[model samples]
Target chain A: MESWRDNRFVFWLLSLPGTFWISLFFIVPLSVLWIYSFGEKTGITDVAITWTGQNYGRVIEPVYLQIMWKSLWVSAVSTLICLLLAYPIAFAICFAPDRWKPILLLITILPFWINLLIRTYALLAVFRTNGYVNKAIGWLWNGIDWLFGGQHPFQPLELLYNNGSVIAGLVYVYLPFMVLPLYATVERLDKSYLEASLDLGASQLRTLLSVTVPLTMPGIVSGVILVFIPSLGAFLTPALLGGANAIMIGNVIETQFKSANDWPFGAALSFVLIYATFGILALRWAITARSKGVEF
Target chain B: MAAVLWNRTPQGPLEYSRRLWLKLLLFATFFFLYSPIAVLIAFSFNTSKRNITWQGFTLNNYVVAWNNPDLLDAFTNSLIIAFCSTLVSTLIGGMVGLQLWRFRFPGKTAYEAFMALPIVIPEISMGVALMAFFIRIGWLTSDVGWPLNLGPIIVAHIAFSFPFVSIVVRSRMVGFNVQLEEASRDLGANQWQTFRYVLVPFMKPGLVAGALLAFTLSLDDFVITYFTSGPGSVTFPVKVYSLVRRGVTPDINAASTVLIAITVIATVLAMKLQAPTKAAKG
Candidate 1:
């Protein structure tokens, strides 16, 4: 009985620090944000606590709507591209020889450790006009000129400061996020199923489609979510690579908090984004649950 | 019969093409991932300050980065924040991991979920929410509120990194053998002695790994720091970001190359430590 009491005391002592820090810094702040969303902005740093839904209604304006749509589609395309690129890499790593598997996985996650800003800067240097890429292209052009007796100088394509570059940056940054989770799932797959499919007269492609894809669907879904969420809220990539025209919802939220002096509107915008993201997650869960024939 | 049928089937053109396609895809994916970083490192050596066009090679860029006072200050600030947060969070996280692993209590599931929540949510949400909470409660500014500086930034770092440490330590504890603890206790060792002599040695990998992860995450953080930090507290990533915005320079490239070197070395060490632990488990 005395030992049981001591154990309880020890448990409380152990749990206090983490619970206190998280409650103070994370949970309270989130609740505070939820409360602020319903208040009205009175001044630059002050807000009135008159409960109003006007801030949320502003989210439907055409400009905001257009930005939201662009953010969604751009993120979707990046997620798709990352999925396509990562699937094979994940497969290769999973099936690699035992001695090499860890090294291969390590290489895939190495880029993730590098600063995102630095990586974007690298992309910027590579894709800049008269940069390394264009210089190489110009060299090739000179070769073509020498071959064909044509003397037109090569012109650099407009690669940076556009939607395409933004998407490219997003895909590069998020590819490891996609690959790691997919590798986790694919590596753990039972190999006998592949053997059974092959033995049943299925070709490689047929077996991959019928066996591998379905089994790795959960990974694909998770990879999509992981890539998509960060891409949707990406401010740095679009700001650095997309120039002035390719602003995202994240840029708007950032401006509101930093320079726009409209905290209420920013809070409302954030809540909208949070709701949409959570709603999608909940919906996906429901669909997955239903598909698995498990009722809740 | 199956052997005869397998011998009769020859590798077809389609199979050959498919194999070639997969090989090309894998090659392209690796090239895409690696070439930019390689180019970045190479250009850091170029003497030119303007474009990435070939210039005379020199190590002057590294010297420039090393000489910049603002960059050095930012680097110092980042180190301080990373160290403090890593220390506090590791201590807290070790305890949390122990409690979660060795004890059963009411609301354990809910507590676990709460621990993992910060990791799953978008960083922007966490950043803005904290900003809102800080400002609304009069903690951000000194005029009408509390004086804010590195305090909020450190708190935010500790908040986010706490989960990472807890998760890693919990996984390590899950693999730990309970017999060692019981044996040590049976031999008349006290709780502190058992923890020091037996548990600490056993949990060293997880503790080191968790601390390293927390430190790295604290160092790499920009968005959360940007929101929570006040003037004069800009971290290294924040400084690099502002520099990138100002213009492209070989000095920035040099700085990034240094950053990349540190992170790569750390990651390799982490993998080395983690590999043995994982292998032993299986």
Candidate 2:
């Protein structure tokens, strides 16, 4: 009894700091999410408290619907690209010699901890007209001119502010997240099952279809969800590298608050995003869990 | 069966093709990752009217960028804010993690999940909400009310970063053997002494890691800081963004290269030091 009392005391004491922060910062803000979504806009910036679904109604308007559709399409493409890129890298690391595995994983993850803003700017330098690729092209043109041809040559494509740039930035930023979980999932997979398929005289392609893909479904699903969720909300990369036209839902939400001076609408937009992301994530989790049970 | 996408194995003839494919894939990936970063680093040293055109190799931009007084001031402000917030949140999170890890309580799971939610939620919402809250209560400006002003900015940073600290620290606490605490008490060491000499030492790595994450997040933040921070409270990233949006200049490139170098070095050092602690999700 005495020991249990001491345990209780220690537990309660340790929990105090986390509990305080969660209540004061996190829980309060999240709870206020629904409130903000329904509140009324008074002055341009201020959201007056009055319950209504008017904001949700406006979310269905064609212009806003277009923005939402674009956001969805971009996120879907980004997720698909991230999955294609991450899967093999994850497979290689999982099967690599144990001594080499850690280093490779570290290399894969190294770029992630660097500030995203800086990384995005780095891409900016590369994509700019007079940047390194252009300079190298100029050098090559001069070389060709000196050797055989007469005059100077072609120009930089100016890849900035394009969909390609935005996709590049997202893939760069989120690649490691996709890789890490896939590696974790792949490493734990048993190899004996593959050997059994081979013994049955099935082709590698057949075994992969019948066995490996089925096992790694969770990783692929989770990876898709992880990449998709954040891409939907990205503001800075789209704002900087994506230029004006490729505006995301996050940029739309920001406009509501800053430029549009429509706080209630901004709040509504945020609530919509949060709901959509969480709702999709939850559905995926449920499906995965159900599959796990069936597999068991 | 090589499930290139569907299976994890290569067929007899496809094995060679697959190995060649992996090599190409790895090279392409590494190129995709490093080319942009290399461009930024290279341009920092370029001497030209145009940052894009290489007139000659020089350190002119670095010299000018570093010498700027406002940039220096912004760096100092960011450092101070990050350091303070990291320390405070680490301590707070450490204690909370210890509690949750050690005992059962009502609402524990809900709280744990709630604490973890900040990581996945959009930072913009958290930043704006905190800014709104501070304004409504008159905690924003010294002239309006409150005996002291750490300013609304610091409060906002502390609030947003609080979740990161707790989640990281709590996960660290989860892996430590609870038997140590029981053994310490059995040996006659009191609770405080056991925590001071043993439990804290064990928890130190996670706490420090959590602190590092908090510090970096605070330093790199722009959207959050823009809303919460007052005049004279610009973070380095926010300053860089404004500078970038205005125009492309060699000075910004120099500044960016230095910042990237710091982050890269810090990340490598942390990874090296903590390699053996049973790697967990990032």
CAPRI quality band, candidate 1 = acceptable
Off by over 4 Å in 2: A1-8, A30-33, A133-155, A293-296, B1-18, B139-151, B279-282
User: lDDT tens digits, residues B110-173, model 1?
Assistant: 8898898788677887899998887767667644322236677888999999898888888888
Q: Which candidate's TM-score is highest? A: 1
Residue B7 displacement in candidate 1 (angstroms) = 19
Question: What does candidate 2's lDDT look like per residue over B1-282, in tens digits?
Answer: 234564365444323224656657867887888887776778788887476666778998989988997777667777777777777777776676666666665676776677667776777676666655655555654363221243565556666676777777677777778788899989999979998988888888888777777777777777777666655566687788778787778888888777777667766665554655766533
lDDT of 1 at B50: 82
RMSD in angstroms, all models?
A: 4.4, 4.7
Q: Model 1: what TM-score?
A: 0.92
Which parts of model 1 are misplaced by more than 4 Å? A1-6, A140-152, A287-296, B1-18, B137-139, B143-148
